[model samples]
Target: MSGIMKISDKEFYSLRSLILEHFGINIQEQKRTLLVVRLQKLLQAQGFKTFREYYNYLIRDSSPDRLHELIDSISTNFSFFFREHKHFDYLSKTVLPLLVERQKKRNSKNIRIWSAGCSTGEEPYTIVMLMLEFFGIEYAMWNAGVLATDISTRALKKAMKGIYSQDKIRHVPAGLNKKFFNKADEGKLVINETIRNNVTFRRLNLMKPTFPFKKKFHIIFCRNVMIYFNQQTRNDLIRKFHNVSKPGSFLFIGHSETLDTSRNLYKYVMPATYMRI
Candidate 1:
């Protein structure tokens, strides 16, 4: 192991505290090893000789940009093409129909969806694929796509390009597999313009000063992202969700998460489902 391999408890806690203060996430005691293992990549980039030196630089000379990189690194972005397929199943059967009807009833054609913490953009693209499949490519009346945002700029960049391999597309449906994508060199699948056409990508840190958007989303999948945050931060995010989400809009959190803790800001529509209050 090299000199940067060393990580003392003091140094670990310092890094942990820095992350918590900036991103409002708390690391459990058991994750110390995970921290050391994961942060190794971060330290290697700086060619720092020790965790001590890196820790001091982050504390004394930390800028907004540095913390952005920290959040991008420290937080887990464990996502696949169509993770937890059941959620999309629900979206296809229950969510999309409701959205279509609601749009027509209100004589509105433009609808919006926000994929918060959209790692590499699979989730939002998945939503777009569903929309294109059900409503057809020329559904000019419903000019809706997705607004995918993530705290990680690196992830957002990859998402905007809209390319993935067979391994990543494992959970995608058979029909969608045949259409909306072309196999490129080396069996990598590229999302055709149909899926990529309307989806927009933005780099957003949820812990920032303001939510910074005026348009209320019809469906916002803030999924699997809040598990890293503390209760207060989670509650704050739910409040923001309420503000940004329309009355009947759906906010999907991670399977392991719930809105019960922040019930005042949301009304339960079903299990693991919520409506903004």
Candidate 2:
């Protein structure tokens, strides 16, 4: 392997601009050293001598998958099952009941949910488990499933595999854990096919100008994903989300993230929760 490829100021700026333009990720000046450290191994493996070469290669690469690889390196995928217990509580006590009532009134059993930026599938799986518990035997009658998406193909692959270390599921409720995961040979827990089948994982870049979802979602969970984006990018992405949400649908963001209620597209239902107007 080549000696650590040094990232000069100009090269760093060039790569920074590329990331901001394409991924909406604003790499602050303080993160310069972190960026270089994180990407050094990838640069060596790809045989790029400098960050400039990597930037050039990224722009010229015809296949979109290369971009996904870059994102996988830069993005953090730290998550656990039922990471935010309150959100699950609100979902079961409020959102699901409302959705069920509305769908019943419409004479439709379809329940649409989108788990945007679902890293490694924990959030979506938690959602599916709740829905199953909510409907119990009637769950089989509804066409309910989660559309889980993230930009990192690497994370999605692990999510699709439905495997996790036993400690990784420590936050999951005991009864749900017993029902949904099978104990594997080496202290690993494998999500049952039933739970895995309820979620569909996809590679989706939230920076896109327009979303191509065929139907508007009843609930959109895009937590913690916007922390990397600048204010403008977050606003723009939220607008796109608004357009793709059904009226009165719920939008769940990270507890640390807040929407500009001044936009009036959605009303504040609770902390980090909004209802589409």
Candidate 3:
């Protein structure tokens, strides 16, 4: 009772500004109670009697680790293997063949894919599995690894482990499960080394003005992440994504999310799917 404190409007706006400015997550009025609920335990644990105290600590901490922890507390990492089945189907049936031919014409075997905001390793590992399925024996000849990144260190740590609860993987197809995952203790599934190695997990704050990649990605999967951002933030982030992807690369968003096709950065191929123009 002594430690728990209600967030005042002033404190809420101050903290919200910090989060929005640094992380690009727009904490709308509707989400204030949600944010309070999420951060209450963290504030109590840190011995902060008020949200203002917590905000002060966050601001005074110069190291990125504190910000990382804040984002970890606030960010949602709700995802499962093959969560959006159509994306995988399209990748395997349509996109991969075209990508293969394009690579061949360039005389390059490099296949770069980025699973932006890949939570808990499911999406990226699934991508690797599909690529393996698509290429089969020829997979060995192609440098077809995926760059999987997220802002939360906690999520990134779990992703790097490549282990998931069996229930979490229930959506994965039977063939892929048998091939890429091995049973773990207490009904968990650990991704096989091959599939695990095919993904490189990194901690990335998407709000950063410039991503650290030297080379542009061939396909970028940034689904469901932009829903937290406002329109301006999403537009700016999309532009940055456009700059960092190769021409004719594919962009996948959440089924419920839509890009502004008027910007001409991408052409709408289907619902939540866009191709770089």
Candidate 4:
């Protein structure tokens, strides 16, 4: 294994540019150390003596698996069940009710929601549970389900397994937690099959020029995902999202992230929430 490898300026720029191009993550000059810290172990384990070598190999490799591994190391997947409770509250009180009313008038029972950048399945599962709670017996009648996607295959694998330690779900309301998760040995909880089946997990890179979704979504939860992107990337990505959503659909972003409302594509509905115009 290589010991104490340092990234030269050229190497940093090369790798940083690749990451930006592929993942829309802008690694600033200040984050040079951060990039190294995140990838040092992978570099050593893979027997690369320097960042340049790793970058070269990445460019030479035709398959996407290596790039996926690189992203798994670089991307931060910090999420917990009910991480932002207010979104669920809004869904239950405002969004779902409104959607139900609209669907009722159209006589269409389809309800589409997308959890873009869903990490470790918490956000999507929470949405499923909320839908279950909201519709109760009628849930089966509506064609409602969550499309959960992330760039990290590692995270998606964990999401598909639907297992979480007790601490990860501590914030989940006791009632919902009890209803949605089954107790596993060693204090881990497995998300129930019903809730698990309601969410479809997929590995997707948000930087793709076009999303392959054939149907427009009614609600999109892209919280905390765009924080890694720069202004231009965010704009393009949000425009793509707008294009793939139904008119008057809802978009939920992270509390720390803000959108330029002046674009007129989306109107501000609430804190970190917007409506497609």
For each candidate in the order shown, give its overall lDDT on alpha carbons.
0.81, 0.91, 0.90, 0.93
RMSD, every candidate, angstroms = 2.0, 1.4, 1.3, 1.2
Stretches of candidate 4 exceeding 4 Å from the true structure? 1-4
The CA lDDT at 269 in model 2 is 90
Instruction: Output the worst ten-in-a-row residue range by lDDT, candidate 3.
Output: 1-10
Residue-level lDDT of model 4, residues 11-47, one tens digit each, is 9999999999999999999999989989999988899
Q: What shift in Å separates residue 101 of candidate 2 from its native position after superposition?
A: 1.1
TM-score of each: 0.92, 0.96, 0.97, 0.97
Q: Which candidate, 1 or 4, has the higher lDDT?
A: 4
Q: Where in model 3 is the C-alpha error above 4 Å?
A: 2-4
Best by the lDDT measure: 4
Pairs of colliding residues, candidate 2: none
lDDT of 3 by residue, 1-277 (tens): 5444588899999999999999899999998888988898887778878888888898887579888878989999999999888999999998999999999999999889999899788899999999999999999999999999999889999999888998789998878788889988888889999998899999888898988899999999999999989999899889999999999999999998889999889999877889999
Runs of candidate 2 exceeding 4 Å displacement: 1-5
Report residue 237 deviation for candidate 4 (angstroms). Answer: 0.9
